[model samples]
Target: MSTGIVLHHLVDSRSQRVLWLLASPLSGEELQIPYTLKIYQRTPTKQAPPELAQVHPLGKSPVITDGDLVVAESGAIVEYLLQKYGNGRFQPPSEGLVKNIYYTHYAEGTLQNLLSNWRIYGMIGERAPWPLTYLSRIIMSKAQHAVLLPTIEASTAMVEKDLEESKTIWFAGGSEPTSADFMMLLPLEILPRAMGERIPKKIKEWVDAAHRRPAYQRALKAGGEYAYAKLLPEASEQ
Candidate 1:
Protein backbone atom coordinates (compact mmCIF):
# COMPACT_ATOMS: atom_id res chain seq x y z
CA MET A 1 0.00 0.00 0.00
CA SER A 2 1.15 3.52 -0.72
CA THR A 3 2.13 5.41 2.43
CA GLY A 4 0.72 8.86 1.74
CA ILE A 5 -2.57 10.52 2.38
CA VAL A 6 -5.49 8.91 0.54
CA LEU A 7 -8.42 11.13 -0.41
CA HIS A 8 -11.72 9.37 -1.14
CA HIS A 9 -13.51 11.84 -3.36
CA LEU A 10 -17.09 11.81 -4.62
CA VAL A 11 -17.55 13.64 -7.88
CA ASP A 12 -19.33 16.99 -7.85
CA SER A 13 -19.60 16.97 -4.07
CA ARG A 14 -17.86 18.88 -1.28
CA SER A 15 -14.88 16.63 -1.87
CA GLN A 16 -13.97 19.02 -4.68
CA ARG A 17 -12.92 21.52 -2.06
CA VAL A 18 -10.50 19.06 -0.52
CA LEU A 19 -9.13 18.31 -3.99
CA TRP A 20 -8.57 22.02 -4.60
CA LEU A 21 -6.79 22.40 -1.28
CA LEU A 22 -4.60 19.37 -1.98
CA ALA A 23 -3.66 20.88 -5.34
CA SER A 24 -3.12 24.32 -3.83
CA PRO A 25 0.18 25.87 -2.90
CA LEU A 26 1.13 25.26 0.69
CA SER A 27 3.37 28.33 0.87
CA GLY A 28 4.41 31.22 -1.34
CA GLU A 29 5.66 28.67 -3.84
CA GLU A 30 3.33 26.89 -6.30
CA LEU A 31 3.63 23.44 -4.88
CA GLN A 32 0.90 20.82 -4.41
CA ILE A 33 1.08 18.34 -1.58
CA PRO A 34 1.44 14.71 -2.57
CA TYR A 35 -1.60 12.51 -2.12
CA THR A 36 -3.42 9.56 -3.65
CA LEU A 37 -6.82 10.28 -5.11
CA LYS A 38 -9.51 7.59 -4.88
CA ILE A 39 -12.46 8.58 -6.98
CA TYR A 40 -16.03 7.38 -6.32
CA GLN A 41 -19.10 7.88 -8.47
CA ARG A 42 -22.41 8.94 -7.06
CA THR A 43 -25.41 6.70 -7.58
CA PRO A 44 -27.97 7.37 -10.33
CA THR A 45 -29.97 9.12 -7.68
CA LYS A 46 -26.95 11.22 -6.70
CA GLN A 47 -26.19 9.38 -3.50
CA ALA A 48 -22.77 8.27 -2.34
CA PRO A 49 -21.83 4.66 -3.03
CA PRO A 50 -22.03 2.01 -0.33
CA GLU A 51 -18.27 1.37 -0.72
CA LEU A 52 -17.58 4.69 0.93
CA ALA A 53 -18.95 3.28 4.18
CA GLN A 54 -16.03 0.86 4.28
CA VAL A 55 -13.77 3.88 4.48
CA HIS A 56 -15.88 5.72 7.04
CA PRO A 57 -19.10 4.87 8.82
CA LEU A 58 -20.87 7.86 7.31
CA GLY A 59 -20.32 6.65 3.74
CA LYS A 60 -19.58 10.19 2.77
CA SER A 61 -17.22 11.93 0.45
CA PRO A 62 -14.37 14.25 1.44
CA VAL A 63 -12.89 11.66 3.76
CA ILE A 64 -9.14 11.05 3.97
CA THR A 65 -6.89 8.36 5.32
CA ASP A 66 -3.42 9.12 6.55
CA GLY A 67 -2.04 5.69 7.28
CA ASP A 68 -4.04 4.18 10.12
CA LEU A 69 -5.84 7.44 10.85
CA VAL A 70 -9.05 8.28 8.99
CA VAL A 71 -10.35 11.82 8.77
CA ALA A 72 -13.90 12.49 7.64
CA GLU A 73 -16.04 15.54 7.00
CA SER A 74 -14.94 18.29 4.63
CA GLY A 75 -13.98 20.80 7.34
CA ALA A 76 -12.14 18.23 9.45
CA ILE A 77 -10.19 16.90 6.46
CA VAL A 78 -9.17 20.43 5.51
CA GLU A 79 -8.00 21.23 9.04
CA TYR A 80 -6.15 17.94 9.34
CA LEU A 81 -4.26 18.46 6.08
CA LEU A 82 -3.38 22.02 6.97
CA GLN A 83 -2.25 20.98 10.41
CA LYS A 84 -0.08 18.19 9.12
CA TYR A 85 1.31 19.65 5.88
CA GLY A 86 0.51 23.35 5.81
CA ASN A 87 4.11 24.30 6.58
CA GLY A 88 2.80 27.53 8.11
CA ARG A 89 0.51 28.48 5.27
CA PHE A 90 -3.30 28.72 4.76
CA GLN A 91 -4.00 30.14 8.22
CA PRO A 92 -5.09 33.61 9.17
CA PRO A 93 -3.23 36.05 11.36
CA SER A 94 -4.40 36.93 14.86
CA GLU A 95 -6.87 39.52 13.69
CA GLY A 96 -8.43 37.22 11.11
CA LEU A 97 -8.38 34.04 13.16
CA VAL A 98 -11.82 34.45 14.68
CA LYS A 99 -13.49 35.19 11.34
CA ASN A 100 -11.69 32.24 9.77
CA ILE A 101 -12.93 29.79 12.37
CA TYR A 102 -16.46 31.20 12.28
CA TYR A 103 -16.79 30.94 8.52
CA THR A 104 -15.13 27.55 8.45
CA HIS A 105 -17.67 26.08 10.83
CA TYR A 106 -20.48 28.15 9.40
CA ALA A 107 -19.95 26.56 6.00
CA GLU A 108 -20.72 23.07 7.24
CA GLY A 109 -22.43 23.64 10.58
CA THR A 110 -25.04 26.01 9.18
CA LEU A 111 -24.97 26.84 5.47
CA GLN A 112 -24.48 23.29 4.21
CA ASN A 113 -27.41 21.99 6.21
CA LEU A 114 -29.71 24.60 4.71
CA LEU A 115 -28.52 23.95 1.20
CA SER A 116 -28.77 20.20 1.78
CA ASN A 117 -32.40 20.50 2.72
CA TRP A 118 -32.92 22.58 -0.35
CA ARG A 119 -31.40 19.79 -2.45
CA ILE A 120 -33.47 17.16 -0.72
CA TYR A 121 -36.61 19.15 -1.39
CA GLY A 122 -35.64 19.42 -5.02
CA MET A 123 -35.09 15.68 -5.18
CA ILE A 124 -38.48 15.07 -3.65
CA GLY A 125 -40.11 17.29 -6.20
CA GLU A 126 -38.28 15.64 -9.03
CA ARG A 127 -39.19 12.14 -7.94
CA ALA A 128 -42.85 12.74 -7.39
CA PRO A 129 -45.40 10.90 -9.62
CA TRP A 130 -47.04 12.71 -12.51
CA PRO A 131 -50.25 13.17 -10.58
CA LEU A 132 -48.41 14.63 -7.56
CA THR A 133 -45.49 16.29 -9.31
CA TYR A 134 -47.00 19.75 -9.49
CA LEU A 135 -48.37 19.53 -6.01
CA SER A 136 -45.11 18.19 -4.67
CA ARG A 137 -43.17 20.97 -6.30
CA ILE A 138 -45.46 23.56 -4.83
CA ILE A 139 -45.22 22.01 -1.40
CA MET A 140 -41.43 21.75 -1.62
CA SER A 141 -41.20 25.29 -2.84
CA LYS A 142 -43.25 26.45 0.09
CA ALA A 143 -41.09 24.47 2.46
CA GLN A 144 -37.91 25.84 0.95
CA HIS A 145 -39.17 29.42 1.10
CA ALA A 146 -40.29 28.93 4.68
CA VAL A 147 -37.53 26.85 6.19
CA LEU A 148 -34.45 27.19 3.94
CA LEU A 149 -34.46 30.45 2.04
CA PRO A 150 -34.68 32.77 5.01
CA THR A 151 -31.72 31.23 6.79
CA ILE A 152 -29.71 30.98 3.58
CA GLU A 153 -30.30 34.60 2.77
CA ALA A 154 -29.40 35.67 6.28
CA SER A 155 -26.18 33.65 6.26
CA THR A 156 -25.17 34.86 2.80
CA ALA A 157 -25.98 38.41 3.76
CA MET A 158 -23.76 38.04 6.79
CA VAL A 159 -20.91 36.88 4.55
CA GLU A 160 -21.51 39.80 2.23
CA LYS A 161 -21.44 42.28 5.09
CA ASP A 162 -18.25 40.76 6.44
CA LEU A 163 -16.54 40.87 3.04
CA GLU A 164 -17.72 44.40 2.39
CA GLU A 165 -16.38 45.52 5.76
CA SER A 166 -13.07 43.74 5.30
CA LYS A 167 -12.58 45.21 1.80
CA THR A 168 -11.04 41.94 0.61
CA ILE A 169 -12.40 39.20 -1.59
CA TRP A 170 -11.40 36.41 0.79
CA PHE A 171 -13.31 35.63 3.95
CA ALA A 172 -10.27 35.78 6.22
CA GLY A 173 -9.00 38.99 4.57
CA GLY A 174 -5.54 37.74 3.80
CA SER A 175 -3.23 38.10 0.80
CA GLU A 176 -3.58 34.34 0.19
CA PRO A 177 -6.38 31.84 0.53
CA THR A 178 -6.80 30.09 3.85
CA SER A 179 -8.57 27.05 5.28
CA ALA A 180 -11.72 29.14 5.55
CA ASP A 181 -11.69 29.66 1.80
CA PHE A 182 -11.37 25.94 1.18
CA MET A 183 -14.15 25.09 3.58
CA MET A 184 -16.56 27.73 2.26
CA LEU A 185 -16.19 27.23 -1.51
CA LEU A 186 -18.67 24.37 -1.98
CA PRO A 187 -21.61 26.00 -0.25
CA LEU A 188 -21.01 29.36 -1.87
CA GLU A 189 -21.09 27.78 -5.30
CA ILE A 190 -24.21 25.86 -4.43
CA LEU A 191 -25.98 28.89 -2.97
CA PRO A 192 -26.76 30.66 -6.22
CA ARG A 193 -27.97 27.47 -7.89
CA ALA A 194 -30.20 26.64 -4.94
CA MET A 195 -31.81 30.06 -4.72
CA GLY A 196 -32.09 30.79 -8.47
CA GLU A 197 -31.35 34.38 -7.46
CA ARG A 198 -30.23 36.42 -4.42
CA ILE A 199 -26.54 35.65 -4.85
CA PRO A 200 -24.97 38.61 -3.13
CA LYS A 201 -22.55 40.50 -5.40
CA LYS A 202 -19.51 39.92 -3.26
CA ILE A 203 -20.26 36.23 -2.86
CA LYS A 204 -20.66 35.80 -6.61
CA GLU A 205 -17.40 37.57 -7.21
CA TRP A 206 -15.71 35.42 -4.57
CA VAL A 207 -16.92 32.21 -6.20
CA ASP A 208 -15.84 33.44 -9.61
CA ALA A 209 -12.39 34.25 -8.37
CA ALA A 210 -12.18 30.84 -6.74
CA HIS A 211 -13.00 29.15 -10.06
CA ARG A 212 -10.44 31.21 -11.94
CA ARG A 213 -7.62 30.15 -9.64
CA PRO A 214 -4.90 27.93 -11.09
CA ALA A 215 -5.20 25.44 -8.30
CA TYR A 216 -8.95 25.18 -8.75
CA GLN A 217 -8.51 24.64 -12.45
CA ARG A 218 -5.99 21.92 -11.75
CA ALA A 219 -8.33 20.20 -9.37
CA LEU A 220 -11.09 20.21 -11.96
CA LYS A 221 -8.80 18.76 -14.58
CA ALA A 222 -7.70 15.91 -12.35
CA GLY A 223 -11.02 15.29 -10.66
CA GLY A 224 -12.99 14.82 -13.91
CA GLU A 225 -16.32 16.52 -14.54
CA TYR A 226 -17.73 18.57 -11.68
CA ALA A 227 -21.30 19.86 -11.77
CA TYR A 228 -20.34 23.33 -10.58
CA ALA A 229 -17.49 23.90 -13.02
CA LYS A 230 -20.09 25.28 -15.41
CA LEU A 231 -20.05 28.31 -13.15
CA LEU A 232 -16.56 29.04 -14.41
CA PRO A 233 -16.53 32.48 -15.98
CA GLU A 234 -15.01 31.31 -19.25
CA ALA A 235 -16.99 28.13 -19.33
CA SER A 236 -18.34 29.13 -22.67
CA GLU A 237 -14.82 29.47 -23.97
CA GLN A 238 -13.87 26.07 -22.60
Candidate 2:
Protein backbone atom coordinates (compact mmCIF):
# COMPACT_ATOMS: atom_id res chain seq x y z
CA MET A 1 0.00 0.00 0.00
CA SER A 2 1.40 3.36 -1.07
CA THR A 3 -0.86 5.28 1.27
CA GLY A 4 0.18 8.37 3.21
CA ILE A 5 -1.42 9.46 6.50
CA VAL A 6 -2.07 13.15 7.05
CA LEU A 7 -3.09 14.11 10.61
CA HIS A 8 -4.90 17.29 11.67
CA HIS A 9 -3.05 18.45 14.75
CA LEU A 10 -4.32 20.30 17.79
CA VAL A 11 -2.15 19.95 20.86
CA ASP A 12 -3.40 17.57 23.56
CA SER A 13 -6.56 16.80 21.64
CA ARG A 14 -7.73 13.40 20.31
CA SER A 15 -5.43 13.88 17.29
CA GLN A 16 -2.49 13.08 19.52
CA ARG A 17 -3.65 9.48 19.53
CA VAL A 18 -3.18 9.30 15.76
CA LEU A 19 0.28 10.83 16.11
CA TRP A 20 1.13 8.28 18.82
CA LEU A 21 0.04 5.39 16.65
CA LEU A 22 2.07 6.64 13.70
CA ALA A 23 5.05 7.04 15.96
CA SER A 24 4.31 3.80 17.86
CA PRO A 25 6.94 1.10 18.32
CA LEU A 26 5.24 -1.09 15.71
CA SER A 27 5.83 1.32 12.84
CA GLY A 28 9.20 1.08 11.15
CA GLU A 29 11.27 2.46 8.25
CA GLU A 30 10.03 -0.42 6.12
CA LEU A 31 6.52 1.03 6.11
CA GLN A 32 7.69 3.62 3.50
CA ILE A 33 5.22 6.01 4.95
CA PRO A 34 5.13 9.71 4.08
CA TYR A 35 2.81 11.41 6.51
CA THR A 36 1.73 15.05 6.77
CA LEU A 37 0.84 16.65 10.09
CA LYS A 38 -1.27 19.82 9.87
CA ILE A 39 -1.39 22.02 12.94
CA TYR A 40 -4.19 24.57 13.44
CA GLN A 41 -3.36 27.68 15.38
CA ARG A 42 -5.86 28.31 18.17
CA THR A 43 -6.78 31.95 18.66
CA PRO A 44 -9.58 33.76 20.43
CA THR A 45 -11.06 35.07 17.20
CA LYS A 46 -10.71 32.04 14.95
CA GLN A 47 -12.33 28.60 14.89
CA ALA A 48 -10.99 25.33 13.40
CA PRO A 49 -8.81 25.65 10.33
CA PRO A 50 -10.38 25.64 6.89
CA GLU A 51 -8.23 22.76 5.66
CA LEU A 52 -9.96 20.63 8.24
CA ALA A 53 -13.27 21.36 6.59
CA GLN A 54 -11.88 20.28 3.21
CA VAL A 55 -10.74 16.99 4.73
CA HIS A 56 -13.94 16.40 6.67
CA PRO A 57 -17.21 18.24 6.47
CA LEU A 58 -17.33 18.72 10.22
CA GLY A 59 -14.03 20.66 10.25
CA LYS A 60 -12.76 18.75 13.26
CA SER A 61 -9.19 18.13 14.27
CA PRO A 62 -7.69 14.59 14.11
CA VAL A 63 -9.03 13.97 10.63
CA ILE A 64 -6.75 11.79 8.47
CA THR A 65 -6.29 11.28 4.76
CA ASP A 66 -4.71 7.98 3.77
CA GLY A 67 -4.39 7.74 -0.01
CA ASP A 68 -8.01 7.90 -1.18
CA LEU A 69 -9.36 7.18 2.30
CA VAL A 70 -10.71 10.03 4.42
CA VAL A 71 -11.53 9.30 8.05
CA ALA A 72 -12.76 11.45 10.90
CA GLU A 73 -13.35 10.76 14.60
CA SER A 74 -10.42 9.73 16.76
CA GLY A 75 -11.62 6.19 17.46
CA ALA A 76 -12.15 5.34 13.79
CA ILE A 77 -8.78 6.79 12.86
CA VAL A 78 -7.04 4.72 15.57
CA GLU A 79 -8.76 1.55 14.42
CA TYR A 80 -7.94 2.26 10.78
CA LEU A 81 -4.27 2.87 11.53
CA LEU A 82 -4.06 -0.25 13.65
CA GLN A 83 -5.59 -2.47 11.01
CA LYS A 84 -3.47 -0.94 8.27
CA TYR A 85 -0.11 -0.58 10.02
CA GLY A 86 -0.40 -2.37 13.37
CA ASN A 87 0.16 -5.87 11.93
CA GLY A 88 -2.25 -7.31 14.51
CA ARG A 89 -0.03 -6.46 17.46
CA PHE A 90 -2.27 -4.30 19.66
CA GLN A 91 -5.39 -6.45 19.63
CA PRO A 92 -6.18 -8.79 22.51
CA PRO A 93 -5.67 -12.50 21.97
CA SER A 94 -9.08 -13.28 23.38
CA GLU A 95 -12.00 -11.90 21.42
CA GLY A 96 -14.17 -11.75 24.52
CA LEU A 97 -11.64 -9.66 26.38
CA VAL A 98 -11.32 -7.29 23.44
CA LYS A 99 -15.08 -6.87 23.34
CA ASN A 100 -15.24 -6.16 27.05
CA ILE A 101 -12.50 -3.54 27.05
CA TYR A 102 -13.61 -1.83 23.84
CA TYR A 103 -16.45 -0.05 25.60
CA THR A 104 -14.06 1.36 28.18
CA HIS A 105 -11.92 2.67 25.37
CA TYR A 106 -14.95 4.34 23.82
CA ALA A 107 -15.90 5.84 27.17
CA GLU A 108 -12.69 7.88 27.20
CA GLY A 109 -14.33 10.59 25.09
CA THR A 110 -17.15 11.05 27.57
CA LEU A 111 -14.70 11.34 30.45
CA GLN A 112 -12.48 13.74 28.52
CA ASN A 113 -15.41 15.96 27.52
CA LEU A 114 -16.54 16.22 31.12
CA LEU A 115 -13.04 17.07 32.30
CA SER A 116 -12.69 19.73 29.58
CA ASN A 117 -16.02 21.27 30.45
CA TRP A 118 -15.07 21.41 34.10
CA ARG A 119 -11.81 23.11 33.26
CA ILE A 120 -13.50 25.58 30.94
CA TYR A 121 -16.03 26.44 33.58
CA GLY A 122 -13.28 26.83 36.15
CA MET A 123 -11.44 29.24 33.92
CA ILE A 124 -14.58 31.23 33.21
CA GLY A 125 -15.40 31.41 36.91
CA GLU A 126 -11.93 32.54 37.84
CA ARG A 127 -11.48 35.10 35.08
CA ALA A 128 -14.92 36.40 34.25
CA PRO A 129 -16.09 39.35 36.34
CA TRP A 130 -19.37 40.16 38.06
CA PRO A 131 -22.57 38.30 38.80
CA LEU A 132 -22.74 36.58 35.40
CA THR A 133 -19.50 34.72 36.05
CA TYR A 134 -20.74 33.65 39.50
CA LEU A 135 -24.00 32.48 38.00
CA SER A 136 -22.22 30.60 35.28
CA ARG A 137 -19.99 28.91 37.84
CA ILE A 138 -23.01 27.85 39.88
CA ILE A 139 -24.69 26.32 36.85
CA MET A 140 -21.51 24.63 35.63
CA SER A 141 -20.71 23.37 39.08
CA LYS A 142 -24.04 21.63 39.38
CA ALA A 143 -23.83 20.29 35.84
CA GLN A 144 -20.18 19.22 35.93
CA HIS A 145 -18.92 18.40 39.42
CA ALA A 146 -22.30 17.33 40.69
CA VAL A 147 -23.64 15.39 37.73
CA LEU A 148 -20.69 14.67 35.44
CA LEU A 149 -17.94 14.09 37.99
CA PRO A 150 -19.48 10.87 39.22
CA THR A 151 -19.59 9.46 35.70
CA ILE A 152 -15.98 10.42 35.02
CA GLU A 153 -14.93 8.98 38.38
CA ALA A 154 -16.66 5.70 37.59
CA SER A 155 -15.01 5.57 34.16
CA THR A 156 -11.57 6.20 35.63
CA ALA A 157 -12.18 3.46 38.16
CA MET A 158 -13.07 1.08 35.35
CA VAL A 159 -9.90 1.98 33.44
CA GLU A 160 -7.83 1.43 36.57
CA LYS A 161 -9.44 -1.96 37.02
CA ASP A 162 -8.64 -2.92 33.45
CA LEU A 163 -5.06 -1.75 33.80
CA GLU A 164 -4.63 -3.75 36.99
CA GLU A 165 -6.24 -6.82 35.44
CA SER A 166 -4.02 -6.76 32.39
CA LYS A 167 -1.14 -9.23 32.51
CA THR A 168 1.09 -7.23 30.25
CA ILE A 169 2.58 -3.75 30.22
CA TRP A 170 -0.25 -2.62 27.94
CA PHE A 171 -3.96 -3.21 28.25
CA ALA A 172 -4.01 -5.23 25.06
CA GLY A 173 -2.19 -8.45 26.03
CA GLY A 174 1.28 -7.64 24.80
CA SER A 175 4.72 -7.10 26.23
CA GLU A 176 5.02 -4.03 24.03
CA PRO A 177 2.60 -1.17 23.33
CA THR A 178 -0.54 -1.20 21.19
CA SER A 179 -3.16 1.13 19.70
CA ALA A 180 -5.22 0.68 22.85
CA ASP A 181 -2.33 1.98 24.93
CA PHE A 182 -1.79 4.86 22.52
CA MET A 183 -5.47 5.76 22.64
CA MET A 184 -5.69 5.70 26.43
CA LEU A 185 -2.27 7.15 27.07
CA LEU A 186 -2.72 10.53 25.30
CA PRO A 187 -5.40 11.93 27.66
CA LEU A 188 -3.96 10.08 30.62
CA GLU A 189 -0.64 11.67 29.80
CA ILE A 190 -1.92 15.20 29.25
CA LEU A 191 -4.48 15.52 32.09
CA PRO A 192 -1.82 15.75 34.77
CA ARG A 193 0.12 18.38 32.88
CA ALA A 194 -3.06 20.34 32.22
CA MET A 195 -4.70 19.87 35.64
CA GLY A 196 -1.47 19.83 37.70
CA GLU A 197 -2.01 19.23 41.47
CA ARG A 198 -5.32 17.50 40.96
CA ILE A 199 -3.76 14.46 39.22
CA PRO A 200 -2.80 11.40 41.28
CA LYS A 201 0.68 9.91 41.59
CA LYS A 202 -0.22 6.51 40.13
CA ILE A 203 -1.55 8.17 36.95
CA LYS A 204 1.64 10.22 36.86
CA GLU A 205 3.73 7.06 36.71
CA TRP A 206 1.65 5.70 33.86
CA VAL A 207 2.04 8.94 31.94
CA ASP A 208 5.79 8.92 32.58
CA ALA A 209 6.23 5.44 31.16
CA ALA A 210 4.18 6.27 28.11
CA HIS A 211 5.98 9.55 27.58
CA ARG A 212 9.36 7.77 27.78
CA ARG A 213 8.79 6.41 24.28
CA PRO A 214 10.70 8.06 21.45
CA ALA A 215 7.55 8.38 19.33
CA TYR A 216 5.71 10.18 22.11
CA GLN A 217 8.65 12.51 22.57
CA ARG A 218 8.63 13.16 18.85
CA ALA A 219 4.95 13.98 18.92
CA LEU A 220 5.50 16.32 21.87
CA LYS A 221 8.31 18.09 20.10
CA ALA A 222 6.22 18.30 16.97
CA GLY A 223 3.24 20.17 18.42
CA GLY A 224 3.54 20.42 22.20
CA GLU A 225 4.91 23.95 21.88
CA TYR A 226 1.47 25.25 20.95
CA ALA A 227 -0.14 23.84 24.08
CA TYR A 228 2.75 25.08 26.19
CA ALA A 229 2.37 28.41 24.46
CA LYS A 230 -1.22 28.58 25.66
CA LEU A 231 -0.14 27.82 29.22
CA LEU A 232 2.74 30.30 29.27
CA PRO A 233 2.33 33.00 26.69
CA GLU A 234 5.23 34.87 28.30
CA ALA A 235 7.57 32.06 27.26
CA SER A 236 6.46 32.45 23.68
CA GLU A 237 6.86 36.24 23.98
CA GLN A 238 10.35 35.76 25.26
Best-performing candidate as measured by TM-score: 1
Candidate 1 regions with alpha-carbon error over 4 angstroms: 27-32, 232-238
C-alpha RMSD in Å of predicted model 2 compared with the true structure? 5.2
CA shift at 23, candidate 1, in angstroms?
0.1
lDDT of each: 0.83, 0.64
Residues 14-82, candidate 1: write the lDDT tens digits.
999999988787622544556788999989977899999999999999899888899998989889888
At residue 162, give the lDDT of candidate 2. 66
Error of 1 at 162 (Å): 0.8
Candidate 2 per-residue C-alpha lDDT over 65-149 given as tens digits, one digit per residue, 9 for 90 to 100 = 8888888877778777777877765666673357335743563556566666667767766666776877877776677667666
Off by over 4 Å in 2: 1-3, 45-47, 99-104, 107-109, 123-130, 190-202, 224-238
C-alpha displacement of 135 in model 2, angstroms? 1.9
